[model samples]
Target: MKALRKIAAQAGVALEEVPEPSAPQGTDVIVEVEAAGICGSDLHVDDWTPGYEFMVPLLPLTLGHEFAGRIVAVGPDVEHVKVGDRVTVMPSAPCNACPACRAGDSEKCQNKQTLGLRRDGGFAPRVTARASGCLPLPDAVDYELAALTEPLGVGATAVRVGGVGQGDRVVVLGPGTIGQALAIFARLSGATDVAVVGFDDAPRLETCRALGFDQVYDLKEPGAMDRLKSDFGGCDVVFEATGKAVSITDGLALLRMEGVFVMAGIHEEDARFPATDFVRRRLQIRASHGARGPEWRRVLAAMAKEPEIFRKMITHRLPLDEAVRGFGLAHERGASKVMILPGQG
Candidate 1:
């Protein structure tokens, strides 16, 4: 099988031939990769300058977490699914008996492991993951869209954590892949005045416009905050997807009294923001990590009902061999959802 793997002591990945994996000794299954979505997580994988990226895989690591593939084989203990079933791989493989999992918040599972982060991932012709982390996809969903099921779950989790609803005026900061996914999910969650604020005055704003945001701002100009304040008598909910400190501060200021503020960005360092602002406004600060396995199913169901609008969000699709081009495009604000077709396209 051909797999994209990062060799030991390097910061790059190459497509190479590798042996197929069989069912794990534990209750795990091996799936043949169909489509894998490159994500913000991949950037962290490529960041070699970092203070340990938490859990860098033992070298020759395959890349990808957000993927959908066919279950080729399953271990004897696997009960929920079997061979021939299509499943969207959940990015995080939680330790089921941990405190977080016992508390019904598996996203924060203590001994959690991830598919792409530590072990081989779906950026291969075939990959293996714990069967419990697999979210079964509907027969009607296309492989490209099925690959997006994980991101859509992040959006669903954000809305739940952010408390967005019918009358809420929401301001979403950043226009990256996750931010755009956040916007679509916010709209579906019944937010009426949905706005997107992007750092650059360029193609991302265009994508925000096309995504049908109620208002789109090229925040590069001065007086951007004043305009954001004018839109709502201060916004009701702010989803901060930009990792920058300024974006976080701006998102905090945009909140209406008693409004919810959701932080979804993975910032590299601590951000300084007005602590008094939350106190003065009586705001609710909630941080949303991406969703767990069942949440992925909700996202898939949402995608199934709204294919026309949801599918259009995929702006680029490339073969796994063109990984660099795909990664560059997805990292840029210019591209929307980008996916890698692992096999025949």
Candidate 2:
């Protein structure tokens, strides 16, 4: 199996020939890799030490988690999915016996095996999965969008955690894929005015206008914060998807009285905030972790129904061989989602 691994710190990923894994024991499935997405966090793999599954493989680990593949084979005990079934792996195979799993917080399972990060992930010809990790996709959804389910799940989880609701005003502080997904979910929650904060993507915003976010602001524009306050009463809920310390502070500054701020970005390190704002307005601040199985499935269903959003979100697609180029392009100005197919695109 030719797999890409994080071979060196802060260096480009390297391709390697690794042994093909065996079939899962008891109840499991083996999926033939199709499309895998390179996530922003995966770029941070240079310094990231896997916390939950640290004992699992680390360096030289296969470097993709978000993917949709075909069920080439399944263990005898598997019943939910069949060979040749088109499916998307949840990217998480949790220990269902753990307390968090029993409580429906599978992301917090005491013993978790997060694909890509913990196990040999999807950046190969094949990845062995627990039958539970595969979510069969409807024919309406294509493989590229299927690989995007992971990032959209992150936004959906943030919406759930932030408690954004109908008639409320919301602002998403970033124009990246996660911010775009968060904006879509905010609109779904009935936010009267959902402002996507950035102008880098005039085109993405124009497409978003088609999806129905009324107010779009470019933070790069002078006095943008004032414009936001005038239009949306200072934002009932502000979400920080940029992961920049400055942007988090900017989000805090824009929050209305008693407003909540959800940090949806994965900042690699500590960031300082204005404690005075907390003292003055009693602001509620919280950070959202990646969603678990149920949230992930909802994101897939939503994408299936609205291909329009996926169309606007996915900007670039390349073959696995071009992954390094794809990663470099992901952060380029005006980029949205960059997807990588394991084989020919």
Candidate 3:
């Protein structure tokens, strides 16, 4: 099998001929990957960013977690999902004995094993994962869109954490894949006013606008903030999806008193914010991590309800052999969601 791997502690990924994965004992399933999505976390690992030291020990690992595939084999204990099922796996698997997992908060389990980060992932034709993590895809969702379920699940979790509801005003900072997903989920949660802000006039910003976002603002433009304030009054929930520290401060500034701030991006460094302002405003800060089982169900249902919009977010697709080029496109500013067809080429 050909797989894309992070072969060194450097700023690139290499495609190499590797042994095809097989299902081992203990409820594992071997999936023949159809499509995989290049995510922002993959970009961080490709660039060897500061917070990615965790990848050092897992060097030479296959680098994809957002993928959907057909099951070719399963261990003896795997009965719920069978061979030939089309599915997408949750990106992380929790140690069932952990305190968090025991209490049904497996997303916070300290002993969780992440797919692309800790083990071999779906950047190849075949990958092995625990059967417990796989979710069967509905007939309405195809492989390409099924590959997006994990990220959309993350967005749903963020919206749930932020307590977004009918008639609430919402603001999302950054128009990347996660940012777009955040906006979609917020609107689905019945937010009456939704605005997305970005520093660059990237293709993603336009993508958000095309997705019918009420307000899409380029921060570099004059009077952007004034327009935002004028349109939405003040934000009841602010989702900081840009990972940059400046976005945190900007989101705080946009948030109304006692508003909820959801940190939905993965930051590579310590982010600074005004403690006094946070206290004075009585703001609530919630950090959203990866999605769990319940959130995955919600995201899949959303995909079923609105498949066209989800399909529109997929702007680029490449063969697995062109993964290096695909990574380049994903890292570029304008690319929306890049998909790698593993079975092709």
Poorest lDDT segment (10 consecutive residues) of candidate 1: 48-57
lDDT of each: 0.78, 0.79, 0.89
True-structure Cα RMSD, model 3: 1.7
Model 3: per-residue lDDT, tens digit, 1-345? 899999989899999999877545779999999999999999999998887787787788998999999999999888899999999988688878899999998667887778888899999999999998899998999999999998888888899999999999999988988998999999999998889989866578888888888589988889987887777655799999899889888888888889999998888778899999999999998999888789899888889888998988888999999999999999888898999999887
Candidate 2 stretches greater than 4 Å from native: 46-57, 95-107, 199-214
lDDT of 1 by residue, 190-282 (tens): 878888888774687776677687488777778776777788547888898877778777777777789888889877788887888778889
List the candidates' TM-scores in order. Answer: 0.91, 0.88, 0.95
Comparing 1 with 2 on TM-score, the higher-scoring candidate is 1
Question: Which candidate number maximizes lDDT?
Answer: 3
* Best candidate according to TM-score: 3
lDDT, residue 24, model 3: 59
Per-residue lDDT of candidate 2, residues 95-211 (tens digit): 789889999986688777778877788878788888877888977788888888888888999998899998988989877778878988887888877888774557656555655
Quick one: ranking by lDDT, best first?
3, 2, 1
